[model samples]
Target: MKKYTDEFKLECVELITIQGYPVRQAAEAMEVGYSTLQKWVRQYREEQVGITPKASAITNEQKRIQELEKQVKQLESDNNLLKKASAFFAIEMNKGGKSR
Candidate 1:
């Protein structure tokens, strides 16, 4: 419900940068969680350090293969259950037709 303003976020970032407050102290002073403060600090550091752009995310073919494999596994399980049920009913019917 309560959302922080851009100015508040920037001030927290700046306080940590200029005043050199450890994440805990900065978070307490700013009335935010330590983990939240740590997250901001990490993002700041990552931005400063710079990162290479990435490609080669999951391909469509790979996603399709995964989906197909899951479907096959589910169908195989269903087929196995059907086979077991058929065999069980056949045994019961044969017993009824015979004796005992």
Candidate 2:
């Protein structure tokens, strides 16, 4: 499967919803699958109404939330790693001092 950017997906949805383009016609013009464009439109509509999608986000706000959530997860993982390393080095230092 090909990955489409959030901007591209939003533009395609706008072409159909805002620009008065038929879903099938827009799909053909944009070289995307008809069903894919249709799905994007549906998701766009749902997002506008404050629905949080289970799949990848279609709107800018949701996309930012997803990005931030990913960053938070990464930071948490790095923090855990750093804590472990600190504890390991502290133990090593204590052992070395005791042996001197």
Candidate 3:
């Protein structure tokens, strides 16, 4: 995944504002996909009601969500492993052998 920096975002905004470049050209010049730049422009417009010189902002909520998702995935894997281990041990106990 590409990590968009503050400077990169500022440059993109500049391309739109100071340079008077079209959205598609600005996006291409900044080495970002058109949709991504467009989304930023749209968000900046919608959120701030088209305030010129877009803000270089990062939403911490995305990082928080990613961390939470990772933890959930780990917990799920651990639960699955425990279930499998329990089933394996149960099979051993039923076989009349020394249980591990």
lDDT string for model 1 (1-100, tens) is: 5677645765887778878888788899989988876766665555445421132112234335556767999999999999999999999999999986
Q: By the lDDT metric, which is better: model 1 or model 2?
A: 2
Let me know the TM-score candidate 1 reaches against the reference structure.
Answer: 0.45
- Candidates ranked by lDDT: 2, 3, 1
Model 2 bad stretches (over 4 Å): 1-5, 19-21, 49-56
In TM-score terms, which candidate is top? Answer: 2
What is the C-alpha lDDT profile of model 3 across 9-95, one tens digit per residue? 657866786678999989877899898988776654453443333344423343345567679999999999999999999997888
lDDT at position 77, candidate 3: 100
- Which candidate has the top score in lDDT? 2
Number of backbone collisions per candidate: 0, 0, 0
Model 3 clash pairs are: none
Predictions in order: lDDT = 0.68, 0.91, 0.69
Ten-residue region with minimum lDDT total, candidate 2 = 60-69
